[model samples]
Target: MLTLRSFEQRDWPSVWSILEPAFRAGETYAFPPQISEAEAHEAWVEVPAATFVACAPGGAVLGTYFLKPNQPGLGSHVCNCGYVVAPEAQGKGVAYAMCEHSQREAVGRGFRAMQFNLVVSTNERAVRLWKKLGFTVVGTLPRAFRHARLGFVDAFVMYKELIA
Candidate 1:
């Protein structure tokens, strides 16, 4: 079993382990593959309104995500999030739980909806999963993502309403 909780300073090591490989992959996220630890920490923890970690009952970290408003001022009603699961924990439903949890949490935090600014086209698994979770591909940005292995690829802007 796994549980979610607010990230703590002590959680850094565990969260960092999960974040490194995913960020280095340069597939799903736009961040550079060789991002430094301080930069990663600042973006993942310092910038987001809330950062969460998924942990096993015995305290092993399984995954992490950061939730924040998609924009400022008039656009702040929409929330945005990013997730990264530990490599060994892939295919085990960690991300599914995180998405479900984020939707509920977003509503509770007063967000009217959630949006994913860039879902890389080649990351078909994520696109499918977001659709399964009720998100829609509202727009496609052509050759928007510079995937490390696939060169330039299209990306989708996915969105889901949490209220109304």
Candidate 2:
């Protein structure tokens, strides 16, 4: 079982443990592979309107995510989000739960749509998962992502309209 809650200062250690590997590997997010703790906090906590942690019944964090407007001012109705699941907890539906929760939360927060501007093409798991959740690759940006191991790689601009 899992519960979602607002991110707290105490949650950083758990969240960092989940994020560090991904950040160091440079396989997923666009952030620099060597990003510092302070930089990570600025991106994960400070920039987003809300950051959430997914925890087990015992309160151990399984994963975390952040939600924010995809753009500024007039474009603010579109929400954007990023997610990371602990390596040990992968394939157990953490990302799925986070995605579902984000949609409902975004709607409640008055977002009309959700957009993922840079879904790495090689992250087949995430691409498939997001598609399963109703997002479509509205556009592809060729060589937009400088994957650490693969050098420049293609990325997708995925979107899902939540409101009519």
Clash counts for all predictions:
0, 0
Score each candidate by Cα lDDT.
0.94, 0.95
Candidate 2 regions off by >4 Å? none
Error of 2 at 80 (Å): 0.4
Off by over 4 Å in 1: none
Per residue, candidate 2 scores C-alpha lDDT tens digits across 1-164 of 89998999999999988888899899899999899988998999999999999999999999999999999999999999999999888899999999999999999999999999999999999999999999999999999999989999999999999998
Task: At residue 50, give the lDDT of candidate 2.
Answer: 98
Predict model 1's lDDT versus the native. Answer: 0.94
Ten contiguous residues with the weakest lDDT in model 2: 15-24
Clashes of 2: 0
